[model samples]
Target: MYEYIHGKVIEYNYQINMKKTFQFSLCGQCYNVLVKLNSKAKKKKTTRSPSPSISIAASEDRINKNEMSSEEDNKSEFVLAYKLFVKTADGISLPAKWFQESISTVDKFLLSVYNKIHLMTKDNTIMPSYYFMIFKTQKETGASTQLVDEQDFIKFKSEYTKLAARKSNIGIYVTILQPSITS
Candidate 1:
Protein backbone atom coordinates (compact mmCIF):
# COMPACT_ATOMS: atom_id res chain seq x y z
CA MET A 1 0.00 0.00 0.00
CA TYR A 2 1.11 3.56 -0.72
CA GLU A 3 1.82 5.70 2.30
CA TYR A 4 0.61 9.31 2.39
CA ILE A 5 2.43 12.09 4.26
CA HIS A 6 1.62 15.60 5.32
CA GLY A 7 4.09 18.48 5.29
CA LYS A 8 4.93 20.32 8.51
CA VAL A 9 6.20 23.87 8.73
CA ILE A 10 7.00 24.44 12.38
CA GLU A 11 9.47 21.73 13.51
CA TYR A 12 11.00 18.39 12.64
CA ASN A 13 10.87 15.05 14.48
CA TYR A 14 14.62 14.69 14.86
CA GLN A 15 17.86 16.65 14.51
CA ILE A 16 21.42 15.42 13.88
CA ASN A 17 24.63 17.02 12.69
CA MET A 18 22.95 20.38 11.98
CA LYS A 19 20.33 18.73 9.76
CA LYS A 20 16.73 18.36 10.84
CA THR A 21 14.12 15.91 9.58
CA PHE A 22 10.39 15.80 10.07
CA GLN A 23 8.81 12.37 10.25
CA PHE A 24 5.41 11.89 8.68
CA SER A 25 2.60 10.45 10.72
CA LEU A 26 0.47 7.53 9.63
CA CYS A 27 -3.17 8.38 10.19
CA GLY A 28 -5.40 5.31 10.17
CA GLN A 29 -8.47 7.08 8.81
CA CYS A 30 -6.61 8.78 5.99
CA TYR A 31 -4.75 5.60 5.06
CA ASN A 32 -7.91 3.53 4.76
CA VAL A 33 -9.73 6.13 2.67
CA LEU A 34 -6.80 6.52 0.30
CA VAL A 35 -6.55 2.78 -0.11
CA LYS A 36 -10.16 2.52 -1.21
CA LEU A 37 -9.77 5.44 -3.62
CA ASN A 38 -6.63 3.91 -5.07
CA SER A 39 -8.40 0.62 -5.62
CA LYS A 40 -11.22 2.37 -7.50
CA ALA A 41 -8.73 4.21 -9.69
CA LYS A 42 -6.94 0.96 -10.44
CA LYS A 43 -10.22 -0.61 -11.49
CA LYS A 44 -10.99 2.30 -13.78
CA LYS A 45 -7.55 2.13 -15.36
CA THR A 46 -7.89 -1.56 -16.06
CA THR A 47 -11.15 -1.03 -17.93
CA ARG A 48 -9.63 1.63 -20.21
CA SER A 49 -7.95 1.07 -23.56
CA PRO A 50 -4.61 -0.64 -23.87
CA SER A 51 -1.65 1.26 -22.44
CA PRO A 52 0.62 3.38 -24.66
CA SER A 53 3.55 1.06 -23.98
CA ILE A 54 2.12 -1.51 -26.37
CA SER A 55 2.64 0.64 -29.47
CA ILE A 56 5.88 2.10 -28.22
CA ALA A 57 7.24 -1.39 -27.65
CA ALA A 58 6.21 -2.52 -31.09
CA SER A 59 8.04 0.43 -32.68
CA GLU A 60 11.09 -0.22 -30.55
CA ASP A 61 11.29 -3.85 -31.66
CA ARG A 62 11.70 -2.80 -35.30
CA ILE A 63 14.58 -0.41 -34.61
CA ASN A 64 18.08 -1.54 -33.65
CA LYS A 65 19.01 -0.32 -30.14
CA ASN A 66 22.48 0.74 -31.30
CA GLU A 67 21.15 2.99 -34.08
CA MET A 68 17.98 4.64 -32.69
CA SER A 69 18.09 3.99 -29.00
CA SER A 70 17.04 7.49 -27.94
CA GLU A 71 13.81 8.01 -29.81
CA GLU A 72 12.09 9.30 -26.67
CA ASP A 73 14.95 10.16 -24.38
CA ASN A 74 13.85 13.76 -23.69
CA LYS A 75 10.57 12.50 -22.23
CA SER A 76 12.46 10.86 -19.39
CA GLU A 77 14.16 13.90 -17.81
CA PHE A 78 13.55 13.94 -14.06
CA VAL A 79 13.09 16.52 -11.30
CA LEU A 80 12.69 15.77 -7.61
CA ALA A 81 9.20 16.86 -6.56
CA TYR A 82 6.29 16.38 -4.17
CA LYS A 83 2.86 15.07 -5.12
CA LEU A 84 -0.07 16.78 -3.43
CA PHE A 85 -3.23 14.67 -3.69
CA VAL A 86 -6.22 16.81 -2.80
CA LYS A 87 -9.74 15.57 -2.17
CA THR A 88 -12.63 17.83 -3.00
CA ALA A 89 -16.24 17.69 -4.12
CA ASP A 90 -15.02 17.01 -7.65
CA GLY A 91 -12.77 14.09 -6.77
CA ILE A 92 -9.16 13.25 -6.03
CA SER A 93 -6.82 15.38 -8.14
CA LEU A 94 -3.45 17.08 -7.85
CA PRO A 95 -2.90 20.78 -7.50
CA ALA A 96 -1.08 22.72 -10.19
CA LYS A 97 2.61 23.47 -9.61
CA TRP A 98 2.47 22.03 -6.09
CA PHE A 99 4.98 19.32 -7.04
CA GLN A 100 7.95 21.70 -7.22
CA GLU A 101 10.15 21.65 -4.14
CA SER A 102 11.37 25.19 -4.83
CA ILE A 103 8.17 26.34 -3.17
CA SER A 104 10.47 27.02 -0.24
CA THR A 105 8.24 29.55 1.51
CA VAL A 106 5.16 28.54 3.45
CA ASP A 107 2.98 31.41 2.26
CA LYS A 108 3.47 30.63 -1.43
CA PHE A 109 2.96 26.97 -0.77
CA LEU A 110 -0.34 27.56 0.97
CA LEU A 111 -1.42 30.02 -1.67
CA SER A 112 -0.69 27.60 -4.45
CA VAL A 113 -2.77 24.92 -2.80
CA TYR A 114 -5.63 27.33 -2.30
CA ASN A 115 -5.28 28.61 -5.83
CA LYS A 116 -5.57 25.11 -7.21
CA ILE A 117 -8.67 24.52 -5.14
CA HIS A 118 -10.19 27.72 -6.42
CA LEU A 119 -9.36 26.87 -10.01
CA MET A 120 -10.77 23.40 -9.64
CA THR A 121 -14.03 24.61 -8.20
CA LYS A 122 -14.33 27.89 -10.11
CA ASP A 123 -16.66 29.05 -7.36
CA ASN A 124 -16.18 31.82 -4.82
CA THR A 125 -18.02 29.75 -2.23
CA ILE A 126 -15.48 28.28 0.14
CA MET A 127 -15.48 24.65 1.14
CA PRO A 128 -15.85 23.84 4.82
CA SER A 129 -12.73 21.70 4.97
CA TYR A 130 -9.76 20.76 2.83
CA TYR A 131 -8.18 17.32 2.56
CA PHE A 132 -4.53 17.16 1.61
CA MET A 133 -2.08 14.29 1.13
CA ILE A 134 1.52 14.88 0.18
CA PHE A 135 4.08 12.42 -1.16
CA LYS A 136 7.61 13.26 -2.19
CA THR A 137 7.33 13.15 -5.97
CA GLN A 138 9.82 13.45 -8.84
CA LYS A 139 8.05 15.43 -11.55
CA GLU A 140 5.45 18.19 -12.04
CA THR A 141 3.96 17.38 -15.41
CA GLY A 142 0.48 18.46 -14.35
CA ALA A 143 1.82 21.72 -12.94
CA SER A 144 1.24 24.83 -15.01
CA THR A 145 4.39 26.85 -15.64
CA GLN A 146 4.97 30.17 -17.32
CA LEU A 147 6.47 30.07 -20.77
CA VAL A 148 10.21 30.57 -20.71
CA ASP A 149 12.19 32.66 -23.14
CA GLU A 150 14.82 31.31 -25.48
CA GLN A 151 17.74 32.80 -23.55
CA ASP A 152 16.77 31.70 -20.06
CA PHE A 153 18.04 28.51 -18.44
CA ILE A 154 15.67 25.53 -18.71
CA LYS A 155 15.32 25.02 -14.99
CA PHE A 156 15.21 28.65 -13.95
CA LYS A 157 13.53 28.92 -10.53
CA SER A 158 12.77 25.18 -10.79
CA GLU A 159 9.39 25.94 -12.35
CA TYR A 160 9.68 23.34 -15.07
CA THR A 161 6.36 21.75 -14.14
CA LYS A 162 5.23 20.80 -17.64
CA LEU A 163 7.46 17.75 -18.03
CA ALA A 164 5.39 14.58 -18.42
CA ALA A 165 5.49 11.06 -16.92
CA ARG A 166 7.12 11.63 -13.52
CA LYS A 167 7.91 8.42 -11.68
CA SER A 168 7.47 8.73 -7.90
CA ASN A 169 9.99 6.70 -5.86
CA ILE A 170 9.50 7.82 -2.25
CA GLY A 171 9.96 4.29 -0.88
CA ILE A 172 13.63 4.42 -1.85
CA TYR A 173 14.21 7.17 0.71
CA VAL A 174 12.55 5.54 3.76
CA THR A 175 14.88 4.15 6.42
CA ILE A 176 14.62 2.22 9.68
CA LEU A 177 14.85 3.82 13.12
CA GLN A 178 16.00 2.61 16.60
CA PRO A 179 19.72 2.83 16.20
CA SER A 180 21.95 0.49 18.24
CA ILE A 181 24.34 2.11 20.69
CA THR A 182 27.93 1.01 21.20
CA SER A 183 29.09 0.59 24.75
Candidate 2:
Protein backbone atom coordinates (compact mmCIF):
# COMPACT_ATOMS: atom_id res chain seq x y z
CA MET A 1 0.00 0.00 0.00
CA TYR A 2 1.14 3.51 -0.83
CA GLU A 3 0.46 6.45 1.45
CA TYR A 4 -1.84 8.94 -0.25
CA ILE A 5 0.15 11.90 1.14
CA HIS A 6 3.54 10.70 -0.08
CA GLY A 7 2.82 8.49 -3.12
CA LYS A 8 2.98 10.07 -6.55
CA VAL A 9 1.57 8.57 -9.72
CA ILE A 10 4.53 7.33 -11.72
CA GLU A 11 3.07 4.74 -14.08
CA TYR A 12 -0.24 4.60 -15.82
CA ASN A 13 -2.14 2.62 -18.48
CA TYR A 14 -2.76 -1.07 -18.57
CA GLN A 15 -4.87 -3.21 -20.88
CA ILE A 16 -7.05 -6.11 -19.84
CA ASN A 17 -7.14 -8.76 -22.51
CA MET A 18 -6.64 -12.49 -22.42
CA LYS A 19 -4.40 -13.61 -25.24
CA LYS A 20 -4.58 -17.20 -26.37
CA THR A 21 -1.38 -19.16 -25.84
CA PHE A 22 -0.10 -22.05 -27.95
CA GLN A 23 2.29 -24.78 -26.83
CA PHE A 24 4.02 -27.79 -28.39
CA SER A 25 4.55 -31.24 -27.00
CA LEU A 26 7.25 -33.57 -28.21
CA CYS A 27 6.22 -36.62 -30.16
CA GLY A 28 7.55 -39.64 -28.33
CA GLN A 29 9.42 -40.77 -31.44
CA CYS A 30 11.11 -37.41 -31.99
CA TYR A 31 12.24 -37.28 -28.39
CA ASN A 32 13.73 -40.73 -28.77
CA VAL A 33 16.40 -39.49 -31.17
CA LEU A 34 16.61 -35.81 -30.23
CA VAL A 35 19.53 -36.40 -27.91
CA LYS A 36 21.37 -38.81 -30.19
CA LEU A 37 21.59 -36.19 -32.91
CA ASN A 38 25.14 -35.26 -33.85
CA SER A 39 26.21 -31.69 -34.52
CA LYS A 40 25.51 -32.00 -38.24
CA ALA A 41 22.10 -33.61 -37.82
CA LYS A 42 21.09 -31.26 -35.06
CA LYS A 43 21.86 -28.38 -37.41
CA LYS A 44 19.84 -30.22 -40.08
CA LYS A 45 22.74 -30.19 -42.54
CA THR A 46 21.36 -33.07 -44.59
CA THR A 47 20.60 -32.84 -48.30
CA ARG A 48 16.84 -32.99 -47.72
CA SER A 49 16.57 -29.87 -45.56
CA PRO A 50 14.79 -27.28 -47.73
CA SER A 51 16.94 -24.27 -46.76
CA PRO A 52 18.65 -22.57 -43.85
CA SER A 53 15.62 -20.32 -43.50
CA ILE A 54 13.42 -23.34 -42.81
CA SER A 55 15.93 -25.03 -40.53
CA ILE A 56 15.36 -25.43 -36.76
CA ALA A 57 18.32 -27.38 -35.49
CA ALA A 58 19.64 -26.84 -32.00
CA SER A 59 23.07 -25.29 -31.49
CA GLU A 60 26.37 -27.18 -31.77
CA ASP A 61 27.25 -27.07 -28.10
CA ARG A 62 24.03 -28.77 -27.03
CA ILE A 63 24.35 -31.44 -29.64
CA ASN A 64 27.96 -32.13 -28.71
CA LYS A 65 27.20 -32.47 -25.04
CA ASN A 66 24.24 -34.74 -25.68
CA GLU A 67 26.16 -36.93 -28.09
CA MET A 68 26.27 -39.91 -25.78
CA SER A 69 23.04 -39.14 -23.99
CA SER A 70 20.89 -42.20 -24.23
CA GLU A 71 17.40 -41.68 -25.47
CA GLU A 72 16.13 -43.14 -22.19
CA ASP A 73 16.94 -39.98 -20.25
CA ASN A 74 15.26 -37.47 -22.57
CA LYS A 75 13.72 -35.76 -19.53
CA SER A 76 17.22 -34.50 -18.66
CA GLU A 77 18.19 -32.34 -21.63
CA PHE A 78 16.97 -29.05 -23.03
CA VAL A 79 16.19 -28.38 -26.71
CA LEU A 80 14.52 -25.65 -28.64
CA ALA A 81 10.95 -26.59 -29.47
CA TYR A 82 7.71 -25.05 -30.74
CA LYS A 83 4.10 -26.05 -31.10
CA LEU A 84 1.28 -25.38 -33.58
CA PHE A 85 -2.17 -26.94 -33.34
CA VAL A 86 -3.36 -25.86 -36.73
CA LYS A 87 -6.93 -24.66 -37.20
CA THR A 88 -7.54 -24.70 -40.90
CA ALA A 89 -9.40 -22.17 -43.02
CA ASP A 90 -11.94 -24.74 -44.22
CA GLY A 91 -9.88 -27.09 -46.37
CA ILE A 92 -6.72 -29.15 -46.39
CA SER A 93 -4.55 -26.34 -45.04
CA LEU A 94 -1.39 -28.27 -44.42
CA PRO A 95 1.20 -28.47 -47.19
CA ALA A 96 0.87 -31.28 -49.71
CA LYS A 97 3.75 -33.31 -48.23
CA TRP A 98 2.30 -33.32 -44.72
CA PHE A 99 -1.21 -34.01 -45.95
CA GLN A 100 -0.22 -37.53 -46.89
CA GLU A 101 2.13 -38.49 -44.05
CA SER A 102 3.16 -37.51 -40.53
CA ILE A 103 6.34 -35.62 -39.72
CA SER A 104 9.06 -37.76 -38.12
CA THR A 105 11.93 -35.48 -37.20
CA VAL A 106 11.93 -32.66 -34.65
CA ASP A 107 13.65 -30.29 -37.06
CA LYS A 108 11.21 -31.09 -39.83
CA PHE A 109 8.26 -30.83 -37.46
CA LEU A 110 9.46 -27.46 -36.18
CA LEU A 111 9.97 -26.10 -39.70
CA SER A 112 6.70 -27.44 -41.05
CA VAL A 113 4.58 -26.25 -38.12
CA TYR A 114 6.13 -22.77 -38.16
CA ASN A 115 5.90 -22.51 -41.92
CA LYS A 116 2.24 -23.49 -42.03
CA ILE A 117 1.26 -21.17 -39.20
CA HIS A 118 3.11 -18.27 -40.76
CA LEU A 119 1.55 -19.01 -44.11
CA MET A 120 -2.05 -19.30 -42.99
CA THR A 121 -2.65 -17.56 -39.67
CA LYS A 122 -3.63 -13.89 -39.52
CA ASP A 123 -2.60 -13.38 -35.90
CA ASN A 124 0.98 -14.62 -35.54
CA THR A 125 1.48 -14.18 -31.85
CA ILE A 126 1.22 -17.66 -30.29
CA MET A 127 2.12 -16.87 -26.72
CA PRO A 128 1.03 -17.69 -23.14
CA SER A 129 -0.53 -20.84 -24.59
CA TYR A 130 1.85 -21.68 -27.40
CA TYR A 131 5.54 -20.92 -27.61
CA PHE A 132 8.93 -21.68 -29.06
CA MET A 133 11.36 -22.66 -26.35
CA ILE A 134 14.58 -24.20 -25.15
CA PHE A 135 13.33 -26.09 -22.12
CA LYS A 136 14.72 -28.72 -19.81
CA THR A 137 12.39 -31.61 -19.14
CA GLN A 138 11.62 -33.17 -15.76
CA LYS A 139 13.42 -36.46 -15.23
CA GLU A 140 10.70 -37.90 -13.05
CA THR A 141 7.76 -37.03 -15.27
CA GLY A 142 9.32 -36.30 -18.68
CA ALA A 143 7.59 -32.95 -18.68
CA SER A 144 9.17 -29.64 -19.63
CA THR A 145 10.44 -28.05 -16.41
CA GLN A 146 12.67 -25.10 -17.31
CA LEU A 147 12.55 -22.54 -20.07
CA VAL A 148 15.61 -21.09 -21.78
CA ASP A 149 14.12 -18.43 -24.07
CA GLU A 150 11.37 -17.76 -26.54
CA GLN A 151 12.37 -18.54 -30.09
CA ASP A 152 12.50 -15.59 -32.46
CA PHE A 153 8.86 -15.21 -33.59
CA ILE A 154 9.68 -12.64 -36.24
CA LYS A 155 12.30 -14.89 -37.76
CA PHE A 156 9.65 -17.48 -38.60
CA LYS A 157 7.62 -14.83 -40.41
CA SER A 158 10.70 -13.91 -42.42
CA GLU A 159 11.42 -17.54 -43.17
CA TYR A 160 7.94 -18.01 -44.60
CA THR A 161 8.56 -15.23 -47.12
CA LYS A 162 11.99 -16.54 -48.01
CA LEU A 163 10.72 -20.07 -48.51
CA ALA A 164 7.92 -18.87 -50.74
CA ALA A 165 10.36 -16.87 -52.86
CA ARG A 166 12.85 -19.73 -53.12
CA LYS A 167 10.13 -22.18 -54.08
CA SER A 168 8.30 -19.84 -56.42
CA ASN A 169 7.70 -22.63 -58.87
CA ILE A 170 5.26 -24.10 -56.35
CA GLY A 171 3.26 -20.86 -56.59
CA ILE A 172 2.78 -20.05 -52.94
CA TYR A 173 1.70 -16.46 -52.32
CA VAL A 174 3.21 -14.57 -49.39
CA THR A 175 0.92 -12.23 -47.52
CA ILE A 176 2.34 -9.73 -45.07
CA LEU A 177 0.78 -9.59 -41.61
CA GLN A 178 0.29 -6.21 -39.98
CA PRO A 179 2.88 -5.58 -37.26
CA SER A 180 0.50 -3.88 -34.83
CA ILE A 181 -1.85 -6.81 -34.61
CA THR A 182 0.75 -9.49 -34.06
CA SER A 183 3.98 -9.57 -32.05
Top candidate on TM-score is 1
- lDDT (C-alpha) at residue 59 in model 1: 36
Task: For candidate 2, give the lDDT of residue 81.
Answer: 29
Q: How many residue pairs clash in model 2?
A: 5
The per-model lDDT (C-alpha) reads 0.38, 0.36
Stretches of candidate 1 off by over 4 Å are 1-84, 90-102, 136-183
lDDT of 1 by residue, 1-183 (tens): 222122122235433333345445544544554565467557756776467567446433543342244323323334435443444444433343334444433344446555654565454454323333232334324433221231122332233343334333321111112121220
Which stretches in model 2 have alpha-carbon errors above 4 Å?
Answer: 1-98, 101-104, 123-183
TM-score of 2: 0.20
What's the lDDT of the predicted structure labeled candidate 1? 0.38
How close is every model to the real structure, measured as TM-score?
0.25, 0.20
